[model samples]
Structures are given as structure tokens and as C-alpha cells.
Target chain A: MKSDSDILTTIAVQFAIMSFLALGGANAVAPEIHRLTVEVHGWLTDRQFADMFAIAQAAPGPNVMIVTLIGFHVAGMWGAVVATLAMCGPTAVLALYLARTWDRFKDAQWRVAVQGGLVPISVGLIGASAIVLARAASHNWSAVAITAITAAFAYWTRWNPLWLICAAAVAGLAGLV
Target chain B: MPEPVSPPAPAAPIPSHAELFFAFFKITLSGFGGTLPWTRRMFVEEKRWMTDNEFNNVYALCQFLPGPNIVNLTTVFGSRMRGPTGAMAAWAGFLLLPFCMMIAVGLLYERYGDVDVARRLLSGIAPAAAGLIVATVAKMATPMFARFGPAPFVIVGTAFAIGVMRWPLLWVLAALVPVSIALTWWRRR
Candidate 1:
């Protein structure tokens, strides 16, 4: 077991790495994080890692919640606190700096180029995240059907998502999830 | 006859840094579930800090960066209004609140994650989580299609092909980036 200081140090380092390289969101760095957690730190097994990821995503709020959950698993309450703050704090500072300078080039050609370039990149990352989630969640035909129907209904109708979530919860309780 | 060159318009009296900070803080704290729709309502319909096109442009830029897109967009918007300090305040308010909540949940989860009810609750929630993702996709796509048309569709199609088909995302991006750039350049020309 790690001491509190060690855990805090680890949290700080991991948070910095994740914050800087979290391009496209937490999901974008997921494959690397999976490697670090399961392979390097041995904090959790691959199966446990996958399960926590599911729980984090299923829970309401930001995807960075995974960092806190994983830290809690590795250490304890302090780990969660350290990890969450570490993950959010430095990036918040950097975002502030970037925001300050953004106005100077409001009409620059490179600004338009960068903006146009990001559209496809975001689409690709979101698509990749969808596929990863599908593979993790859809273990059986029933689960597959749930996924498909959820996608279809959301794509087609104006139904509130809370209702669909409720339906799925009921389905899972019935051993269909 | 020679045309006269017009002088640039004077900048509007923008919000004070503190005002900008609080406005963004409010936006972040109140927005839950999917935030895009609420963000549109606030920025476009309510505060009118930016036009729809400007908001979309900033959003597009944020998406390419790492971290949460909404948080990043908040940084950009806050920065536009009040400079770096405002951006920091907005990001801190937005991320700090959510992080605290998530950490609380994580603590509870660590203590009681293996409980049967917890397991059952999570299992039930998984499908709902999937639905939320779909909801987010639709919410984003609507304004995208309405405003930009074929471009967004093309981006989606390319993404599906690369991600679902297991084609290399880098290669797909490589091919499309130039095409998108070329099209924009041609249109400008």
C-alpha cells in the first residue's frame, strides 16, 4: 500500500499528464490510462478497470470522475481529493492563460484553419468513444438491442433522455441489461 | 468614383471581469446532464455574448483540444469577455463544483461499490448512460446540420467509417483535413 504522500505525488503527476494530454476529453486518453493503471501501477486488474470506467460514465457529471474513482480504489478518500483537484487545477490555469491571448488573433487565417481542423477531429474522437463503450457494454443480444434502440430513439425522436434511462434501468433490473 | 474606407466600429462596453466570471460560473454550475442545449440558450438566446456562428466556431476549436469541450469552450468565452483571470474563474467554478460532487460519489462508491443494490443500480444505469450519449449526439447534430449542412454530415460519415469500420482514424483524418481545407479555400476564392 502507498503512503499518503506517495499517493498524493502519484495523483499530482497523473493529473498533470492527463490534463496536458487529455486532448479530445478523458476518453481520448483512456487507452493510455488503461495501460498505466492496469499495466504500470497494477492498481486494478483489467476487468476492474473496465467496470469502473462503466460506472464513471454511467454516473452523472464530467468524465474526469474516473480519475477520482480510480484514485479511491488505489488509496482512499485523500486519493480521491488529490486526484480530482490535480486533474482539474492546472488545466484550469492553462485554460485561463489561453483565453487571455485568444482575442489578439480573432481574424487570423490560422485561426480559421485550426477551427476547421478540429471539427473532424472531434467527430472522430466521439465516434471512437462510442465504439469503445459499445464493446464494453454490449455483451449479449439483449444488451445489443438496448444499445441499438437507444441510439435509434435518440436519433429519431424528441423524447427526454431521462425516460430512456429509466426504461433501461428497469430492463437491467429484469436481468436484461 | 473612389470609395471611402470606413473606420472600424467602437468596441461595446463589455462586462467587468468579475461580472464575466460570475456569469460563466452560473452557466457551469447550473448546467447538468447534457449542457449544449442550455449553453445555446444562455449564450445565444439569453446573454447574447456571441452570435451563433461565433459560438459554433469556438466550440469547434475547443473540441480539438484535450479535456472537456464545454469547459474548454467556457475558457474561450470567458477569455473573450474578461481575459485570463476571467477564464480561470470560469473554469475553476465549472470544474471544481463537478469534481467535488464526483469525488463524493467516488468515495461512496469505494466504500459500498460491491453491495448488491449498488451493483443493480449501476447495471440499470448503464443503458441510460448510453441513451445520454445518443441524446448528446442529437443535440449537437441538430444545430450543426441546420447551420452548416453537408459539411457536418460529411464529418459524421467520415467518423463513422473510421471508428465503426475499424479503419485508422489518423489516415481518415489525413485524407479529410486537406479536402476540407481545399473546399474552404475554393469557396473563399
Candidate 2:
């Protein structure tokens, strides 16, 4: 009873904190989200997390929609709304304020170093996300094959990513994966 | 090279609040692969609101700030145009359609996500989605590895700590960011 409300509150608070730490984007925090939801709380499984990621990617929006789906999964409609807002709202307001002073420091040395520093960490966080998600998404030999082939094609070619997703879906429906 | 924010080249008309909203709404709808490129087109190409230089500067700023880079770009760009409320308008427009779409998708997933067919379909999509992320990381990393430095170690250390070690992220960043910045600062100096 009370625990339900507490859960939502926790979700809101944690997501708010995550927005600040989300260096590259929501993708950069994928590992962190996985840790909190699937590990710390046991609210979701690795499989469920991967599924939500797939659904969000399939939708035509920012990858941040994954947070919306997770919120909805945990606590229904209001949960969804709260998570999305928590994830986006505070950072947005912060961005509004920061934009004012940012232009003045456009070429500041500290700014350059900060950007340079965060760049590697951001890429690494994203890399961590890829590894964590790949482990979750791969369930069998065929699934591993799908991940490998998709990664190869996506890296080597310029075909639209949507096509790869579509092919993967068809293969799945056909029981090939 | 980084430059001061200046309205160089040709200046496009400053967008009204409504224009700001619609431009982003249209970009969200048009974006399939990703919104960033489409945003670049609309702001710099079609609308001419920003020169390429101006856009790049904003990109650098938004990327530096925490949270979603694209979402922050909308806020920063909007605020620049018409102050805070302008920021609200752009943010709302950018998120409105996607938010609705996600809710609807969420509802459907809640109902049917575990059904056998849907499960199979999702199982298929999941791995490929993960694959796409791998490819994305590769592309982002290739540029960094062009010259060997502490960056590769930073990347591997962070990845191992979080992805494998599953360390609490905030603590990891607290430790890593300052050291990483200092190294970069010394290098740049």
C-alpha cells in the first residue's frame, strides 16, 4: 500500500538524479537504469529491460521513451508520466538557464577540457550500455547470430537502421532467432 | 576550431513561439533514423535560423551539459530565440508527439507484450537493437582511438566498472570526471 507510493517516489527521485548524470544521452545511462530497475529493485528482469528498449527504438521518438516505458511498466499511467517528467524536466530547466551564460564561454579552455574529458567517459558509458544490453538480448545461438550480423552490417554499411530492425523482427517472427 | 557565438554568414528570421513549436514538432515526426540530422537540416538549412557555426557551437554546449543532448538543444536554442517560455514551447512540441506515441505503445505492450507472437517479435528486435547500439559505440570510439592516449583506458575502465562491475554510477563518475578533466586540461594547456 504505502510501499507503492514509495516506489513511485523513488522512481521519480532516481530518474531525476540520472538526468543530471546522463552525459551523452539517455543511452549513456542505460547501464545505470538497468542496475536500478533490474538489479537493485528487482522491478524488472533483464529480458524485460531489453524488450522495453526494443519497443522504444521501434517508436518514432527520442530514445528517452525507454524511461517512459519502464515507468509505465512499474506503476501504470501516472508512473509513466512521472518518470518521463523526472527524466526530462529538471535537466531541461537547467538547460534553459545554462544557455544564457554558455555563449559567453564558447571558447573557454576549461570548457574544452571538460568536453574532451566527458567525451571518452560518455562513449565508455554508451559502450557499457551496449555490452549490458547485448548480453540481455541474446538468448540463444540464433539471437547471438542476429546481434553479431546486425552489428557488422550496421558498422560496415550505410543502410537505414530501421531496415535492420525490421529484418530482425521478421526473423524473430519466423523463429529464425 | 571553436569560435565565439556570432551571427555570421546570413541571419535567418528569428522564429516566433508557434514557429519554434511547429519546427520541432515537424522534426520529431520526420526523424526516423535519428532527430539530430533532421534538426540540423531544419535549423541550419530550411529555416536558416542558425549558421552552421552557430549550430555547432550550440551542439558543443548541449553535448557538454548533462541529459539528452537533442532535448537540451531544443531548450537552449529556444531560449536563445525567445527566452524561457520559448524554451518551454520548443520542448513541449518536440516531446508531445513522441510522448503520446510512447504512451500508446506502452499501453499496447502492457496488454500484448508477453503474448507468444509479440514475445517472439520483440525477442528478434531486441538483439538487433542492441547490435545497433554496438555499432553506434564503434563509430563513436573510432574517432577517439585515432591517436592513442589515456582515453582508451578511460573508456575501458568506465565500461568495466559499470557494465561488468556494476558499480554505482554516480560514485564512478565522481571519481572519473575530475581526473579525466585534469588530464585533458593539462594536455590542452
Maximum-lDDT candidate: 2
What's the TM-score of every candidate structure? 0.72, 0.95
Q: How many collisions per candidate?
A: 3, 0
Candidate 2 on A1-177: residue-level lDDT in tens? 457789889989999999999988988899999999998988798888889988887778799889988998899888888998899999988887777776687689997788789999998899999989888887898999999999999999999888999999999999888
lDDT over C-alpha atoms for residue B60 of model 2: 76
Query: Lowest lDDT 10-mer window, candidate 1 chain B?
Result: B1-10
Steric clash pairs (candidate 1) = A22-B66, A23-B66, A24-B66
Tens digits of per-residue lDDT, candidate 1, A85-127, equal 6766666566556555655777877666655555644554555
Summarize candidate 2's per-residue lDDT along B37-100 as a digit string, tens digits. Answer: 9998888878888888878878877876789888999888888788888999999999999888
Report the C-alpha lDDT of model 1 over B1-189, residue by residue, as the tens digit: 133232233234566677666666566566554556777667666666666666666775566665656667777777776677767766665566656666677667767877877666666665455545555555555666676533575557655654466454445556766776655555444
Best by TM-score: 2
Model 2 chain B: worst 10 consecutive residues (lDDT sum): B1-10
